[model samples]
Target: MKITSTKLIAATVLAMFFVNNSAKAQSLPESKLKFGIGLDGILPVGNLTNTANFGLGLTPRLQYGVSENVAVTFTTGIYHFFTKEIRIPSGLPGQYNTMENKLDLIPVKAGVKSFVSSNVYFSGEIGVALQVDNGGGGSQFIASPGVGYAGDKWDLGVRYENLSKTGSNSAGFIGLRLAYGFGL
Candidate 1:
């Protein structure tokens, strides 16, 4: 009898926890989807050993609530990276006025969102980052993550992107995103 009572109590607690989690799953302040535009700073890390130069980019995003705390977002944008220094195996640095690796990326992602309070929410997206160009170039695969806040008229975001798909293909891409959203 004691064992059964303990199991019942545990089940009740677990059910309550799931109910609470299901309620706190979104960041939007209203009932509609949001459309946003923001600035981006995409930079490569540890590439030019002694180089402090970084890349600049821009992003436009669409966010919809699959649930209160889970959102599906699709982002498409351009990334420009300038390299004043790049470390070589020769133990020296090379300079490039413009790196041809700059690209246009369309990231299709689904993110889990948790509303910290009323107006602010933390979110993360893990999805396919597809690369394409206007010059009839090729495409590659990337992984992306983002965190943002919802405002009265807009949403602000910071994102990390990974595109260097070599070996295990684990490279890190970090950037900032600022956007404004409207309902559908």
Candidate 2:
């Protein structure tokens, strides 16, 4: 995976969001509604790394607290990857053409987060990833599992994501997320 300067800068900015919002974690307030923004570093692994390179993206989310320890969230994000062009030979001899690959991934998902401790939580989300510029397939199912810390108004988490078709190729990656929440 290529760790470009842009990716590092983005990751740093996202981390700052958490730090800035967490300035006063001495008291954790209870809120019924919260909004969050986050950044993710997408490292393609397993079969996914074979075709695509690393990616970076942003996620903005909204959550409604169902109880003191549980919340339901609606999330969406865009992840961009780098891929090489594909060359296909025409029927004519000595003729070849290239196809473009737009490695943009957009995922719209909804899930639940369960807080096991005051500062620790586990979450799962399911949705479809829309593959922009994919000729053969335009969409694939995605499932993500995340674990992280939660504060009165901020959070930090690590997540694993899977994107795939039932009988086709699959992609996996690990991502880090930092988010800030506001009480309703």
Candidate 3:
């Protein structure tokens, strides 16, 4: 039931992302590379045991535009965090600990985006991610549909990503990237 709801929400967001196309095309500079950073806060929606300590996170990414509608990205950093209050039943005094509880994943995704109208786009990408904790193995498939405006020097976007992956449970990290893309 949760999976079904998640899929439905993803589909609706994608539909909104593709709803218009008549805006002007903002030209990019000679360089195709763009850089961006974002703040992300998420609760474990489909897989998890706790939502009590799912703190906010951040992801920074860089992308190179292949054309107006296609791009590839490399993200060198991501963080998962938590804060837990521990109580000792026997020995140690009770304490509150804020554990950023970080495990970083560096991912490179080669993907494409298509503008449904001038300001809305749909994107899909697949890539390998190296789990920075325990040397475990994992990979990801992220498909996002977004709406954005290309400012004179940057692109501002809001997107919903259906991020599927392996090993997040053991890795002590969240399973996805919900982000904003900036054209560098």
Candidate 4:
């Protein structure tokens, strides 16, 4: 089933409220710097689904705790999308030719992570995604909002990311990230 943005936001808020109310409160890491690397899997949505079957990403992030329950983050990543084969009708009857297409992107973002409970957090980011392919496509603006579980050394998150450019349709995906973090 397709998830609408309103539903996603409502779900996240409900989860945060329940977790915060039911779980024992714990302190967030304060005044500390941490680094993490994440492996991401994405399912193409919206216009992206037309061309890409799936995507994989490698992202590295740096976080600095600014308060008891808030952190500022910088993240960069490379994402590659595996595309479906496109079939074109050949001159011969009942014959077709297939061509493969792929897309590569580099994203740079800055965001904030806010802990609601001890181990659950909400995050949001805004950035630019630069398309690096033979087509020489330009950059697009990106926005992502997510919710996650963060333990001492591991984190798992789910997010919706949208990329858009002027005069063009938007593209997006629902993504999951698994990461390992360490204090720096």
Best by TM-score: 4
Backbone clashes, candidate 1: 13
Sorted by TM-score (best first), the order is 4, 2, 1, 3
- Model 4, backbone clash pairs (residues 3+ apart or across chains), number: 0
Off by over 4 Å in 3: 1-23, 27-31, 49-52, 55-58, 83-103, 134-149, 153-155, 160-184
Tens-digit lDDT track of model 2 for 1-184? 7553334434443443343332322213335677888887777777777667777888888888766566788999888877667778988999989886668878899987666656676677789888765662578887777778888778888877778777897677777887776666
TM-score winner, 1 or 2: 2
Candidate 1 per-residue C-alpha lDDT over 55-167 given as tens digits, one digit per residue, 9 for 90 to 100:
66666777766655546666666665564533335444664343334345555555555454444555555556565554624444544444567765666666555454445
Considering summed lDDT, which 10 consecutive residues are worst modelled in model 1? 1-10
Candidate 4 clashes between residue pairs 3 or more apart in a chain or in different chains:
none
* C-alpha-based local distance difference test score of model 3: 0.48
Residue-by-residue lDDT tens digits, candidate 4, 111-148: 87778878889887789999898686689898888989
Q: Please count the clashing residue pairs in each candidate, in the order shown.
A: 13, 0, 4, 0
The 10 consecutive residues of candidate 4 with the worst lDDT sum are 19-28
Give each model a TM-score: 0.61, 0.72, 0.52, 0.84
Off by over 4 Å in 1: 1-31, 46-52, 85-110, 130-138, 166-169
Superior by TM-score: candidate 1 or candidate 3: 1
Candidate 2: where is the Cα deviation over 4 Å?
1-31, 84-100, 134-137
Candidate 3 local Cα displacement, residue 85, angstroms: 6.8
